[model samples]
Target: MAQDKIVFVYITFPNSEEAQKVGRILLEKRLCGCVNLFTNINSMYWWEGKIEVSQEAVLIVKTRESLYPEVEKEVLKNHSYSCPCIAKIEVSEVTPCFYRWLLQETGVEI
Candidate 1:
């Protein structure tokens, strides 16, 4: 595993309410440093052998790579969907100040 790698976990919610709820849970648990919620986004995807389109809320979760498993678990537990889109994308580059703040906010270095 890469050392001190930061990742962004993307998850889509049916509505802004759900997004805010899960975001708060993740923050309270210290599983993520920050969550940016984008509401009223249109998404089209294949589900149940059919194409579907809907307005969804997107959550951009910022956390350390080491905490991804826990983050996944929490999202699965709290999310409404049977199979939520919880994906972790690694951050290849981050400034020292922001990285330090992220680690501090997440208590990853404590």
Candidate 2:
């Protein structure tokens, strides 16, 4: 996003309710400024020596890199599963308005 800001956070939940729960927790604690939920996603992964594919709700979190650790911690704390999926990637593009709002809302230096 923006010139110097990064929105590197994504997490997947078993369902909409779990996604909503994690999203609200992050926002309430200011660990994240925005979290977009994608209700339909096909995830294929290997777990416990088995390949599994299933539909899941994905959470796209927008926040500074500085907040990543805290965001992950909070997600783990509120997540329903013992081990959750958290995929953090660097954002290469975002609208200026969205970036500004994100930075301003999170109280992060830009």
Candidate 3:
């Protein structure tokens, strides 16, 4: 994917409140154009050399690829987990109108 293309940053939070808090911060800072919150997600993963299971809320941050660092930094600063799940998934395609809107919302020149 192109460096300037948009991406979806997937982040897992302990609960909805924390997810919303961080999502709002990212929006207010214009680090991300939009955020979608998916709460009450069942997650199972390996941590500390053991399998762990928990209920978590997911925050999908829509932002440009170039702004990933800033988005990550802000998330790390506000996240409650010492090792939070922040993964960037590149968007292969997006509608032209939506792309322009996203860029505009994030304060990027279209």
Candidate 4:
């Protein structure tokens, strides 16, 4: 895979406020070009040997694959959850214009 390929960092927060907080931090730091937040997402998963369900906010960060480590580190530092869900999804493709825009916004050489 290309090192500079765009990727989406998917994260879940306790609430929209928390999501927005971290999202802004990522943007301000230029770790990500943009973030899309979805609130009131119903999540069900296993936690501590039991099933848990909750309403959470999703923060999808658009950034370069090479910046995943920094983005994950920042998210871990600012996130409230002890074990926050931070997953990186490599984008298969994107529009040329948008890709260039993302690279420019993230300070990547286009």
Indicate which candidate wins on lDDT.
Answer: 3
Candidate 2: tens digits of C-alpha lDDT, residues 10-94: 7888888889988888888887777889997889998799999988998999897778888889988888889887988998878
Clashing pairs for predicted structure model 1, backbone only: none
lDDT of each: 0.92, 0.83, 0.93, 0.92
Candidate 4 Cα errors over 4 Å, as ranges: 1-3, 47-50
Comparing 2 and 3 on TM-score, the stronger one: 3
Question: Candidate 1 on 17-90: residue-level lDDT in tens?
Answer: 99999999999998888999999999999879999999999999999998899999999999999998998898
**Which runs of model 3 end up more than 4 angstroms from their true locations?**
1-3, 46-50
Q: Give the TM-score (vs. native) of candidate 4.
A: 0.91
Candidate 4: Cα lDDT at 72? 94
TM-scores of all candidate predictions against the true structure:
0.91, 0.80, 0.90, 0.91
User: On residues 20-77, what C-alpha lDDT tens digit does candidate 4 reach at each position?
Assistant: 9999999999888899999999999988999999899999999989889999999999
Q: Give the runs in model 1 whose Cα sits over 4 Å from its true position.
A: 47-49
Q: Return the number of clashes found in candidate 3.
A: 0
Instruction: Please give the distance, in angstroms, between residue 89's alpha carbon in candidate 3 and its true position after superposition.
Output: 0.5
lDDT computed for candidate 2: 0.83
